[model samples]
Target: MTLRHAAFAAAAAMLLMGPAHAAELEKLWEIDGLKQPESALYDASGGVIFVSEVVGDMRAKDGDGQISKVSPEGKVVQSGWVKGLNAPKGLGLSGGKLYAADIDELVEIDVASGKVTARHKVEGAVFLNDIVTDGAGRVYVSDSGTNTISVLESGEVKPWLRNDRLNSPNGLAIEGDAMVVASFGKPAAAGQEAVPGFLVEAPLSGDSVRTLGDGSPIGALDGLVVLGGGKYLATDYIKGGLLRIDQSGSFETLAPLPSGTADLSYDPQTKTAFVPQNKEGKLTAFRIP
Candidate 1:
């Protein structure tokens, strides 16, 4: 065969096999009737999922916010498992407590009794968006409005990192000694500009910031999940999509959804992911491989 023919055949073979074997997300289930569900947490041991329902305007302090309990099979076990919150967003589980990021406080809930345990007010915080807990029991909460990260240690909330380079930090996760953050990009007025979001990494014990994924914007990122081994999954809130970013900062789209993918939860053992479609008012699960 001619060299050109052989090359063409090889290219065709790759095209045929690429998508068939590429990473994909299989829809497992979806739970509807949620009022602006914004975050999901998969509790493997309890076999339940906790979803944050931001009922009214995101910025309003309307005491109508709550958390809902759902089964792994996408059933709303209790629509209002915990109530009386104010614009709750991100959620993290540690020390037998569930820490939720409210507008300006880190609200802690007793996981066993579904009761409010403590509300640690972050001084001068605005739009607290995401929460994470490290192995040392240090709780980190991100403030998107102020572009700062606050820490809860020894019952005190203090600023951990404050840098303009954060660019509206939204979602956060702890990977080893580094803190992974999904930025909402530079803030802009409506119709003034279209600023794409990105990701960054900071040392847990230091104050340096490093951009991720080829230094290119990823489009209004929200929920971030570390998929182990220098890989991560981040949801695009504006585009309503999911992406897999490798250690080297290269990314690929796993799914393109409606424009409301908020905070995400994943189970490593099952390779299952739970995403709350905020505007759609639904909680969807997908099996990622």
Candidate 2:
């Protein structure tokens, strides 16, 4: 089989309700990692990088399952040691306060205090996947299990966009007054064709959902972020690579982010994108040309 067909087959396997470990991925970089390190973010002001080690071995770091901070020279370190979190998936930081979305709750941590200052309840949330903050400081959480988006305002948990039809909402992005989400379709069935995922544009003020590009062969569009100028950079789990989609739904292949990335972040000021894959356990950096 050709490379593209092989990737499609891999995605078909994923849709059939199998684990990510079931497939072998193309090597993106020469990096060795941990059990499942999901999402990553760039802290430009502090000159440090942060990534979520979702499920880790205590012998590797500590039992806290903290977010690792790697420096420019590849020196690895950690901060905000969150102890016994029920799988911290995606992380976001604003004004130096770190926000973590674990399966059960959204917790706020203050590095100065080294304590979880506040924790809020996410309603109808069976699994809280990704947590992100738009520049205005409003926090959004992708509750994948309930098919809803949870918003945090002034430290209070508020529900937003509850729609069951949204099958497997995997990633979050802000696009001109709406939340552009990538939906990976329902579980794959044996011998059934793998369902293709698409980018849906949902307004922030209300529930007006519209699909931008239908029948997207890229399949599982996970960990998306604005690439500036109304375009996006997304991780394609099925294809075992990264993808770039423009404003008009025109897309191009970005690069390889194999091992399935969870959440992605970019520093436009520096033109760098950080991809964190749970299965890869390695934080890889890509410079947008």
Top of the candidates by lDDT: 1
lDDT of 1 at 198: 81
Alpha carbon deviation, residue 209, candidate 2 (Å): 0.9
- As a TM-score, model 2 comes out at 0.79
lDDT (0 to 1) per candidate: 0.89, 0.70
Give the per-residue lDDT of model 1 (tens digit) for 42-78.
9888899999999998988899999999998888899
Model 2, span 80-103: residue lDDT tens = 445655567778777668888777
List runs of model 2 lying over 4 Å from the truth.
1-31, 56-64, 190-193
Best by TM-score: 1
